[model samples]
Target: MRAGWTWLAAPELWPGRRTAGEVVLALVLGIMAAGSEELLGGEGPRLAVVGIAAVVLSLLRRRMPGTVLAVTAALTPLLSGFAPLLMLVGWSAGRRIVGAGRALAMFSVAFVLFAGVTLQDSWSQQAPMTRLLLTTLYFLATTVVPGLASRYWTQRRTLLHALQERNAQLLWERELVAGQARLRERQRIAQDMHDSLGHQLALISVHTGALEVDPELTPRQREAVGVLRGASVTAMHELREVVGILRDGVEAPAPVDDSGLVGRGTAGIVGLVESARTAGNTVELRSAGEERPLAAAADHAAYRIVQEALTNAYKHAPGASISVELRYEPDSFVVEIVSAAAPAPAPGEVVSGGQGLTGLRERARLVGGMVHAGPADGGGFRVAGVLPYGVVEAAPFVAAEDDFRQQSPKAATVNGLPPMDWTVSARELAGGKERSRAGGIAMGCGIGVALVLVLVVAGGFALAFLVGSMSQGMIDPGEYESVKIGSGEDVVRDRLPNGDTITLMGLDGKGPKEPEGSECLVLMSSDVGDSFETEPVFRFCFKGGKLIEKKSYEVSR
Candidate 1:
């Protein structure tokens, strides 16, 4: 019982189960169609046959939808009992057929066939032109319109799914970026500690070693100095190991300034600018307001921001002039670097990991600061940072990264990177383009359907009016009487008009019952006119290639 319930609850849990469900649905629809036909006075046996055929065709609709649609249309007039099945095939065709051109061709073929069959069956019935028009409209409404609508619905669902998947992928990538940013920040911290604390330990080791060899020191004093030297060396080794763990097995480069004062504070800026100039890059430094002391973390963050900006300028802009500005406001310190744009670099001239700006932003965030980097007003790049004088308690790294991700895109940088003008990946751009294309296709389909509907309605009305004005199928009273009973079918047809006009009046089916096992033809009289209050019609029954009965009747307009 549990297994049965599981299968019922989720039929698609196993292969072929969904197809089985579809087949069951088709069977139910077929049964309904057959029952409906019987209720509407159709022959039970014939309707059952049609229903079975409809079921078979519906099952193949997915694979050969266009072919199935055409076949169903051809059978429509003969099997009016299976109209529901016809509509199902049409809708399936619209959904399965790819591309607008192919769909249009398939629908057009089906529509024409349906219209032709309907006209052939009803041409001799009362008000044939009007009936034809109404039937055509009904066919479009039930079959064509539903099909087009189904196609549109399917497209919308597919586009929505693509957008959802793309959004999910972007969210995953954002989390990955945040993780990478946190790791890089930790490595930066490790490098800073190694430069400063490792240098001090080395100095201590050197001094203790010197004291151990001093001739003036007593034996106990020399022994104490030897122990201190050994401890300092061990501490240095441990520091290296910790730094290695932080850097994830990557070795940190030696500091440029051997004294370890290059990225300490404002003093470091002076040396950094001089070094850039020495490296054949034009550089200028400006300072404003009263110089004040800053928290250790903030000071280091400030120096690093300047160093990264200057390095980027030198690498990317090559010959462009760079300006580093410092403002020591009462509440905060601001550091801004602007570099003019230069000629494009030669192939392979510059290789960048694209992580420098991200690292700067992370460094600033740890010290309660924000960094903004983007294009400047006059064809250049600018990186500006605002740091608090007093260090604030740092937020969790993941939380801080999340805050950056939620920042407005209008800002100069997002998630520690520059604006997306140049940073947007090709894959992201392609996704955007795909969404736009999908929207355009959906709009075009809607417009095309509306246009087709309008054209069909207008044309159908015009044709009905033209057909009503003609009298090509009307017979005079004398010709109707000349068609005697027992006449050969050919002789009777030759005596009658070229065409029949049962469209002058409506049929009630209350006339004399048709002869058993015989075919009948109904025609209009020539006395009928547009202004007539009543119409005269002639009915002829034929059996075994001979006319068996002839009758005349009158119907109110």
Candidate 2:
């Protein structure tokens, strides 16, 4: 099996060329473990050299990590931090075999061992016990922290590579599909225009030829005929261009490629407003917060989101008073387009029934961004999107689209299908960047959560130590004080000082005498009594070498 899968599983071909580095790290860890015996306990050099030899061989972990790991583990028993060496070797081997998850498990074992060693080292010291415990814990934590971190990094890199691979695959697939779609669209356009415009042109030509044959026509009539002929020729040329678009498909004559970090953001969105205003629609453009750099993907997505929103406003609700807003929030950028319903445009006034909103939604989804469109409480359409600040690579698939309106007279954005120059490309919008940044933020937060859990566990252990060991002869210094308090006027008379809560009791997985807790439950009761009384008593105590009881209060109907 090893020989058969040798090529498939070769470590040299692992992503990012990291096999060599991993091997070196494994070896270093092994040698360190080997040398620790001499430095820590003044042991003989024989065991040390053996360890070094094992380590030297352990460098092969990347290619044959399991074998190297086994050898090192068997050789390093007497060395200091031997567990760490074993763990690193495990990771070196495991990461090559399983994934980051298994490597992490190996790292966890090493981390626990380091903590145990630190705890043992910190005992019998002159410092206060609490101080000793804390220092020891932190020291152990720091010792193991690197291992834990490496585990995460290994996982993170592996996951990232997986993401990139998936992304690459997706991108390849999208391009392939986009190519086919462009071709299909071209074909559809060709069929449509040929059937419609082609017949019209043929008719126009026949009409002009008839006029030419009619010699009895007067000079004015002849001039009119000439005008008709000219119009027909012009129409034919226009139709031919349309057909050319379909036949030529997305292969634009000119090429374009560049990250267009140079494009306008606010100004670009503003243009849509100006165009709308010129068309008799009322618009207000509002900007907020300082502008920041965004990657190409986000910038373009933002622009498209706004453009489509504005287009929808004009097409479906012409003359609507529209407000366009761009705001910078804590972790994201925001774009909002709001407009009043100007009454559905008289059929002729509206060019489209409503495809803009649908289109924008699709755009948002691509970046894992979101778009919310609905009628406002005040009356009008509201389109809002939250996006990331940066990471919008200025290149998008639309760059290659021939159908995209040319940004300038002399140049245009190019797409996949043998299109124009690669010099200029569109950037993704701010919202896309925001979402991606948000995803990264979430990842950091997740790791932080793990750290928090570690701290919590350490704290609980600290607390347990305090509880079990700290005490005066009769009482702890900071025990809860006995005090007098009053209840609020609205307090229910039927209830006691404590609420009626239920605790769920099951046999718990352990046998009948299990020492654990089951789930909890809650219960409520109506007014059992209308008045409060301080008559009930229940208490027990055992701190001062004696038992004590205290009176309690209750309310009864």
Candidate 3:
């Protein structure tokens, strides 16, 4: 029961389940339609069929709007009294369809059907001229008005959805920029700490080893120096591990040695392949073309690219065979690393933090390079990067290093050092052009306002004309003029349009009650020149169903 209620509340939960709002609307419309049927003395099975169809159509209005409208229009003539339900269908169509041309077509088809039904019914009771006028008015009321209102709402809804999506996209872009800035800051800190602290630790280890070999020291003192040298060497390795964590925000399978503390240089690629082989993975390295010289930044980026790829293979494919290839061209250096797929992970194996590939991409992008990583052919993954030769000249790095050297000794401390500007420059470089759409917005609003004004003016004039025509239809001026005193009841009814007679006791507010046994019929008519203005009235008294006295005079407002 709970699941049923949940499905009813959310139509999106499952297909074909009616929403609470739709069920309520359908129920209300069905009941009102049944009332219309009974009012028209439609108590048979035909009315039942129409009522059932209307309810079912209303329930499916959002899903199949055009089909429901077409079926409703076809049934309108036989069930003309069910006009309210049909108008609701027209409203739904207006709100759902987007284009004005399509909406107009739908309204036109419904109008034609409604006019046919109205004309057939009025034909027997009304004159040829009167039937046409009534059919047009009924058509406007049943189809045009409701559909136009729905179209207006549909336009507003579409605009609102677009604005919301744009706003969300802007928010996402802002967060992405902020996150990139933070990651860059972490990388700069890691670089500075590795340079300063690692140098000091290496100096301490070297001096302690020198003291252990000195003949001037006692035997016990020499033993203490040996312990000190071993501890300092261990501390240096641990510090490199910390730097790697700071660079990528994740524990890596291999510690990064990009700081040059290990003296790998351009030959670092060989050591990386050896390390991968040592980690129980089969490794192969291939090189093409002659080796070429590169700037410090480009050299480091190339080395880091190979290092990160090998590290990823170790983490994600532990026992897989790997191939590392480096191609040297006239103006570019390309590296590709491919690894075979490993067995499925064990049940409780440690999961990756997913930052390695992102760091590699950012690293390449900083030096005007690109990296691509994805599944390779035949059940393995491939990581590749292309670094343009001479992309980062020595000038920028040399200038930054010179400025750092100029700072005071105390200011070299990481906490005391000024914030770097290279990051800010990189951010500005990555930010693309931004353009404003104000001109288009202004033009769109102007066009929208003009259309609304046109519709309003047109609707106003149409309503005025229809009201004027219908009012004029009620009282025929020619018939009123033809009625004479002493005319019989049949003559009076024949002169009038609907056989409606208003009994009056006066003419121009001055006469006796019932016209002294000759009942007086007062007929009023509106001036056709203006919609709100009324014209003069005529009174004719009848005796024994025959008119006896007649008078004509204007009635004041």
Candidate 4:
């Protein structure tokens, strides 16, 4: 009723089903667009328009998807980014506006447009396969296909549920008709038995009463007839009630428990193990690694794995010892259940299969994990599943946000401590420090260029001042000549504990004023070992408290 019925005013229907994919596309576009612009040196009005538009488009994507896509596409040729995104959006819109079948035709045109833009960035179509593959994926996988596939699955599930309900109704009707026929037959039998048997019994009763009154009637005969009459009356009443129930012909459904169903967890698994042991079967449960609050999918998988294994053991092995291990790790948790093979399984002994393993696999996979089941190497059959410990770190929390945050920390460390210098620790770094680490060599290069620029600008100004002063005759011939224009060098040197020379230099236009002198220095962190460098060095004449020398740097490791 929720979906089958029409809804003009419902809020959920309009934005309805954004799909993880659309959001991902928007993110990719934003990040790639931002990165490429920064790579080419983000500046100028054109870059600003495109950058702002791409950001806006990413956030409000679903509302005006085509327009957003078009904006990004138009900006691609003017800016520097993959233009295929525009086509992806165009395809998605065409699928919605016209039809999904038309999506390919529109998307092909979009791909060609992207290829044309790509040509401007690189001359050779040498990486044609790469571009084509990426383009094709963007067109098909990221947009049109996802929307179409989603629709198909949703519709398929709805149709299946409808068919189930209809089948239930049809089955109920057929059973109702069959019961009506049985009830009619029972009614007729009841009538015949009541009419014929009751009349004869009544006549016999009268005769018995006469006999009892007569002195010739024996006590034994009187007692026997009295018992027969009583038994017949009781049978008549019981038959009538049975006839009424058959006549009603409705299923007396077992009561529905509004208390809802109990969910299985660690405790639930323990109880089930205990119950099995009580039935004279041996069962053991073991857990390893740091405990975590599992995601619903993982928890469900764990519960079902043990439940199915135990059920199978009960049906086949009966009294075999079983071991269940729930090993939690940094990245995942493993659920292993082993049960001894049945000594003599009955002919109709049911293997615990059908949907159990399938459901468990699906559950595990849903959380970016997997399941395994096989005969154990030593003896019994084993079912083992690995559930991703930090599934949400790779995805947004769709169902339980609070629970996910609480579990993510310990879960991310399951497999091992992250690679060196990489961690999920909550420690915060200063902005300057973060920039230094992330920016690295490139930042060093930038600082070098900035230093060159600053020196060039300052030298020009210093030269101009000299020129103007000379024009005003403020300097004598010797004064200008004596201030010899020579190559400048500012050296930073230090004596190491091991007695090695550490030299840092600022090289610029050759001038007499540089090198082998008291060079201006800023920060001196000697602990960094041997050397360090910074550029676009600030001087007192060009600095203040509200100042930032915004110079870039290069560091050698």
Candidate 5:
């Protein structure tokens, strides 16, 4: 019941649904039609019936556009006020009508009705030719032009709706794909941590176990060895638990809560280099500037950088010499690992899958850092990264918010996603220059359109003025009145300076000029004519440059 009520209340959901405004418009159209008929001395039963029918049918235009349009067009000749109702019906048909053939047929019917009614009403007052021309022009302007404009508007609305729907679908699909990719990436990270760090812990346990059983060591040293082995085993167990949670897509507890993992932060950074040296590799480790503790994320990123670099070296370079350099600046930590190219593996060397560097890059980005890993200039490979002390998590999709901001018009003047200050900072840091160029291009296009419109309007006004001047040229009635059969043609030419001559055809058609090949001129009043009655026009004929004849006759309008 509530759903039905909601559906009825929302007129926007259905195009044909009548709202309060539509009802008001129908009533107003009916009243205006009736009032216009009364004002035009057409107050009678027929007038009242036509007015009522027009109002009632207009209200149903959305549901029956063609029928309403035909009825309105039929009544337009009787009630000039019905023209508005007819135009409204035409607009509705253009917007709501489906097939082009049907729309054309309906428009044809309306055109015929309008032309017939208009011709019948104007036939008595206007000549048949005039009535026909006027009827055709009126039908084109009132019916064809408005229909075409409304059709174009409807097409644009449909296109906009389609684009919006496609955009929404694409956004939904993108979000789903991103979620899946994020899950897979998190799982991969968990597995990489287990494989790399777990191996280190296992080695520690094995070496400590071997030392614990030695007889040469004192009781204190043996006890310390046992404690170290026990700690390594315990760490391995905790690592497994964390990896399990990651694989299940659950949020792992905070690093500290999960046995102080982040607190141990960059402790593994130096061990990574030492471990490589212990494993029969010629590796040199150097540090410049004072070493200071970093933020949790930055410290973790630093440890991962060294770990992945060494892992890559051990797999690809094998016995090649490697150099690891760490530079601690005032506000950042930089790590670089450079290794010489390696020879072909003798046998049983681990093959590289290129996953270590991928993980390293991900880690660096998460900690507001950048990583570069590629072949170096001197026939070696370099893996370098820079980690800032105060790290911020890089947003996964920073540009997407800009699109949302543009499409959404809700509370647009106020910042919705973030305050203007933050938005400005983000845009500047994330290619604001490119967006500025786009905005400049858009603004330029708008200015060009405005300039073109102004030019077109000015040109139209100038053309109208030129035509008016050419149409009403200078005419001399006194000189024409004095001209007789004995006058010279030169005197007549001097009287009328401005060139104003037209073919003296019958009522704007060809009639006759006295004597074949003789020069003839027609002179008439310059004042604008108001009545339809024919006016007298003076005709002059000149033979051998001498005015020979003059006559006057009425020219039919």
Candidate 6:
């Protein structure tokens, strides 16, 4: 019972401001229909009753569109004045009904009822065959054609909305994938730093500690050694804090062996060059400008950039001569590595993941710098990086995690690890494409349906006009003049044409009043052509079986 009440109180069915507006429109239409009926010598009150009843039923059209359409169609033939209400309900039914089969069934029932009533009325009045055909065409134009148009329009709007929503969802998913990729990259960088830099600092602390206890060391020198040991330990501690920030809550995996290629700043680069020379590689290191201390991140980034470039040179151009240059500008530090032309690698001799250069760029960017790498002037590759002197703090892991949670709560992992795959799902792409295709089909179908409806209505009106013109009742002026005012009804009837032009033309009340206590007959003048201009009409009134009055007048066609 509660559910039933809720259903009844739905906004579409319940009376509110919209209902009030509908009522006002209905009342105005009813008054106009009633006035037309009274002018045409019909019962105005009867037409007004039909109009009011149809409007009342129409109020539920949104909730019970099929029922409303049926009721309105059944009432249409009682008075043609209610036909507009029937058309409105038909359109509402089309928009609200979900499936084509259901709509077809509902509209078919309405058409049958409307046609039956119209045919019955015409048969009772002995209407011509053309009148029956025209009535059927009128029913199609007012109800079925308009209903199809409304259905097409509603479907087009719904499809467009669906497509828009799908496009927005796809865009959001793409952004999420990119964010996850960046988070994963940051974790990788933190792991690399922990393995290489932390290891180097620990070694420094061990070496300094051993030197401080040497038997031959002077007191001041030993004190200096102790300070160096303390500084190394502090650097290691700071490196750990930075790694923690980059790692967020996720523990990085154990690091692989780095093959002893670890150091810091200019000292590290010199050691790296010596190691390369000891490995039987042609290598040179040049430095210029006054050396100055670099920010922690920039120092580490510079070391990694050279390490990666040397690794690439060893792998891709095993025998190429490599030159490493370092420049200290006023505001920045520059590292450039160039390898001379070398023969192409033998098949399977060298394998590259292609992430080395990308990592170089990412490292430089994190330190407020940029990297450029491409083929050198001759053949071998070149990699260069510009790193700023001032420290650029790494992004806060806690804030990033919170932002990720806010943007995509479902994407969070209990282990705090980003998912491996950051590419958009194939299914989502397919779904978007399918929606676009459906929208296109719907648009094409709507345009086709509209064109067909226009053609059908235009053809129907043309046919009706041709039939009406041919069936019009017309009499020659000589025959009308020969019939005196006092002639018998049969005599006047024999002189007239066998049709009622006034009824067919719908010009019943647009003329002078008839004589009192008499029956009247109206016909068209034969001399007047059927066109959009004035035409002469003849009216004859009879009393007591004899013609008492006859008159002629002109009315616009």
Error of 2 at 458 (Å): 9.4
Put down candidate 3 lDDT per residue, 1-557, tens digits, no spaces.
Answer: 86754533343454344456667778777777777878878788866776687788776666666767776876776776467777777777777655778777766776676667556645334244545554565556665666676676557656655654454454456556776887899899989988998999999999999899999999888877776786588569867876887888874443345554333334678877866665457999999978887655566767877877887787777788899999887777788999888776534565777888888777766676778999999988899987766755222323455443243222111223332322333332223233124533654466457545655765686577655544433454666667776668778756654422211112234433446766555556544423334346656667787777766556444
* Candidate 6 per-residue C-alpha lDDT over 440-516 given as tens digits, one digit per residue, 9 for 90 to 100: 68865775577567658767776767657644576777877988989898888777765643253543446799888
**Per-residue lDDT of candidate 5, residues 1-557 (tens digit):** 74653443343443345455676788888888887887888767966776787768776777677887887888887788887787677777786678889999998998788778766644333134534554665666566666766776668656655654554455456556776888898799999999999999999999999999999999888877876786687678768867887788663533342334443356555655655766668999888999887887677777778777887887777888999988998867888989888865535757777578888777776667778999987777999888887745442323445334433222112112322222432333333346646854765465446545655665575466445544333344565566667777898666553333221223322335467777666555454445657655566777898878876555665
lDDT score, candidate 4, position 112: 59
Put down candidate 1 lDDT per residue, 1-557, tens digits, no spaces: 75743444342254477657877878977887677777878885778786798777767777678999998888877676567777788778878898989999988898788888878856546457766676677678767876887798778768766754565556556757876897899899898989999999999999999889999999878877776786687569758866886889454432344566633466688877877775557898999999998887778778878988987887788878899999998888999999988766634668788998998888887787889999999898999998888867553323645654443333333345443232344234334556767866877677568746766876787677657644645678888887789999998877765443434335446468888998877677777554566667778888999999988887665
Deviation (Å) of 64 in candidate 3: 4.4
Instruction: Supply the TM-score for candidate 1.
Output: 0.44
- Which structure is stronger by lDDT: 1 or 4? 1
**What are the TM-scores, per candidate, against the unseen true structure?**
0.44, 0.37, 0.41, 0.33, 0.49, 0.49
The TM-score ranking, best first, is: 6, 5, 1, 3, 2, 4
Q: Give lDDT tens digits, candidate 2, residues 192-304.
A: 98899889887987898788669899877876676667557655765676577677753222112143322234446665566566556788988888877554556666877
What's the lDDT of the predicted structure labeled candidate 2?
A: 0.54
Compared with the true structure, all predictions reach lDDT values of: 0.74, 0.54, 0.65, 0.51, 0.67, 0.71
Model 5 gets an lDDT of: 0.67
Taking all chains together, the TM-score of candidate 3 against the true structure is 0.41
The TM-score measured for candidate 5 stands at 0.49
- Which one wins by lDDT: 2 or 6? 6
Kindly report which residue stretches of model 6 are placed more than 4 angstroms away from their true locations once superposed: 1-48, 124-129, 168-189, 212-231, 249-460, 467-557
